[model samples]
Target: MAVSRLDVFYRRLLLTKLFIGGWGKPEDLKRIFEFRKIIGDRERCKSLVPKDYPVYINKTEDLTDCQIHDGFFMSPLEHLVPGILPPEAVKARFQFIVPKKWQRNRPVCIHLAGTGDHFFWRRRTLMARPMIKEAGMASLLLENPYYGYRKPKDQRRSSLKNVSDLFVMGGALILESTVLLRWLERDGYWPLGMTGISMGGYMASLAVTNWPKPIPLIPCLSWSTASSVFTTGVLSKAVNWTELEKQYAINSVYEEEIIKLLEYCGADSFKMMPNLLKNVNSLEHLLGLSGDHEVSVSQYSKTQMEAEVDGGLQGYRAGEREQQLSSVNSKGTSLDTVTR
Candidate 1:
């Protein structure tokens, strides 16, 4: 289907407005992605997490579709920075689901959800498991910091106010993912991968960077550079850019120390290329260790600079990334990466 010329003109006009209305200094961008020294730091990877942090499997019940293991882990962030974490973020939560057919050496994808994504929106991930079971893999869908049990009681769904809240979300998720992945490894899940759609993709990217070993990194509907999303995408219209600018000034983003602090965050100057390259190296490692290269790009768009995964073309996502409804009941169907 062809896009209407009027819609293109409207979007271009919106982009123009975005540039003039909200473009902040380069220094301000740092505050968003690197406000915390621990945002993407491998050295601080799970450092806040303690040894033998408890996992409470409060409830486990067998369902018709699959068996669910619902649980929570101690929030390392609360301990790492006293009195700073939101009350709801004090514990990391997760829902681990697997088909009854799950057995040894099955692949597990650490599935992530997008920002403010909760309630009915979660079914998008849960529905993928039957297909995974057909392929003999397991799905571990993690609840992000600001979603599920980690959400503050006062904050509405996906409602994170203040610039500090955003930093806390990123920091907490990065740490939480590390802890979960480590636990999964200890339990012996081979060829594990991380994937998510949109902001979840960004979080997954950050998580893989801190991971020492190579694993699959599939971020559907997301790009290496997030600054563009906040500054130019349709989301810009929803986010309060002026408020963020004021917060930057208050945080002293222009201070020389602040600049140096962010610059120290990476080898790629926080453009996410270092993390992206790390993902590529991990892909090579997966090939050596598992003898299979699974890159499933479910959807593609040229304007987004998204590379094809499984021969996806234009808007037609032609691949077996997600098992079709008919295939779910069929045995021996394998899954590649986590699809949102």
Candidate 2:
């Protein structure tokens, strides 16, 4: 039987998610490295640090002296992929606000902004200034990829036209977040937490979940599972599916095939459980559940074994890890998976 266009697109998404979710495994990592090597030529990975970015510090001199510092920030460090554009094609700025008294030792809170563009968080930082001041914690804000100062002028609004672009941008943002966090940690600033709303929130969740070195994260107003959005009919509007499908139709014939592959691989199902659980553990267990009420663990495990005959055990293990991670609430929120 032939698959529909939608099914193929779904499969592509599944494969992409599986690839990203499995990034930490040695074998999976090797596969990714190989894949990149085949596609990326011999070019060196892109640098997370920009050239000649300045750092600024502002101090408030009342009874309690507070300070704000600015510099280039990198987060979720991974290998960078160079663009076809010039070296200066993308530029970004990052700012940190801290209480002057605690400058010697302070936990850092990195703020990621939502969809409008890069540097949108700059204004958001201003809005959050009073709360940050009162809380007496240092706050850092960095640019989102393809937004604000980081966006290449020629690509304005163009990047948002495709779903693949969104995923690539998200991956880049994740890489940037990791790199920035590591850089700050090396400089003696501890990453206390990360917070964002909407798209930023989604990115924040990904960073926390996939960080090479874990960091506390507070992701507001974001769903836990990609499946929930995509399968629940909400994706059509949230992601502008109509537009995405149109673009994919024009750009590539394999889009449908990829989507179908993702669906068969259960990407849609894996993406939705987090939001439904509200808490993490239940979410994880649910994800790990390979069978319905009628099926037993042995049966499910056997089924998984069958699925892995050709794909390798990494896919099964990836599913298990995602479930395990989802079940635990690392953020200590009211929605505690353990306690509940």
Candidate 3:
């Protein structure tokens, strides 16, 4: 599609508002700095999670709107800091939607919730039915940790009090996706895929990179990297730089040290962008990476699985792990006899 001159001008104007102009409206800069902290310390950020995690499914019910499977699991972060979270917020819940006549051969798509996404709850039948009934595709929706069913009682709509809270949100989504992807694959579904609209799309990209095999990844209406989305996009205007600098005791938002820190954590750095935009089984040329590995490491984090030994690294064992897991049934020649 060709872009018009007016569209280009408008976009540039928006950019001006996010940057060169005064501190754009009043958004929380502390949160943005926390974002920077995550970028700078990739390994530490990933370490906040357990390398091997478990998920428990409570029940599955068939409703007039859709067949929803409800489940919950303890977050890897639960162990990182024991007993700080109340019991109610400790266990995370999720809903999985399947087509009315879900068959063995149907493909599964994990639909992630964007920030404050209400479409899934408000328009269940109208929003997801066509994808299932007409397209023969199954939908597995994961409610973000701090949003939807798992929202903490005290938290307001889609708002987090601390910067670590945001990183935890992203990490929790990645881990939960791991648990569900394992279940889907273990259940014998073939040609697996993942996708999301916006923030969901960014999280989906993170999940797929950690996944072993190259399945169809359709991150619709999204990009490969998250840096630009926050640093220079419309969202930046929402941040409160004056207060954020005050919180960190900094004088300038564009201080040389601060700029370096932000650049150091860019999504393109340390291979996050390139690996994400791989030309293998991913949708061709839709999204890309930026720089900076982002700190937020766990004892288990690393860009690739092979890079670390003690607790593992960024991506879930990438090539080595996928090879070990058999996609097809070894006992039976075809998928029919595969163990579920």
Between which residue pairs do clashes occur in model 1? 116-158, 135-333, 297-309
Error of 3 at 197 (Å): 0.7
Q: What is candidate 1's lDDT per residue for 97-193, written digit by digit as tens? A: 7667656676777878875566323633454565555666667777876677677676544655433555566666777787777777777777788
| Residue range with the least summed lDDT across 10 consecutive positions in model 3 | 331-340
| Model 1 segments more than 4 A misplaced | 1-35, 43-51, 119-127, 245-260, 264-340
Stretches of candidate 2 above 4 Å error? 1-65, 73-79, 84-89, 117-128, 154-159, 226-243, 246-252, 255-257, 260-340
Model 3 residue 179 CA deviation (Å) reads 0.6
lDDT per prediction?
A: 0.57, 0.47, 0.53
TM-score of each: 0.63, 0.52, 0.57
Error of 3 at 22 (Å): 19
Q: Residue 331: error of model 3 in Å?
A: 58
- Model 1 RMSD in Å is 14.8
The candidates, ranked best first by lDDT, are 1, 3, 2
Q: Pick the candidate with the highest lDDT.
A: 1
Of the two candidates 2 and 3, the one with more favorable lDDT, higher being better, is 3
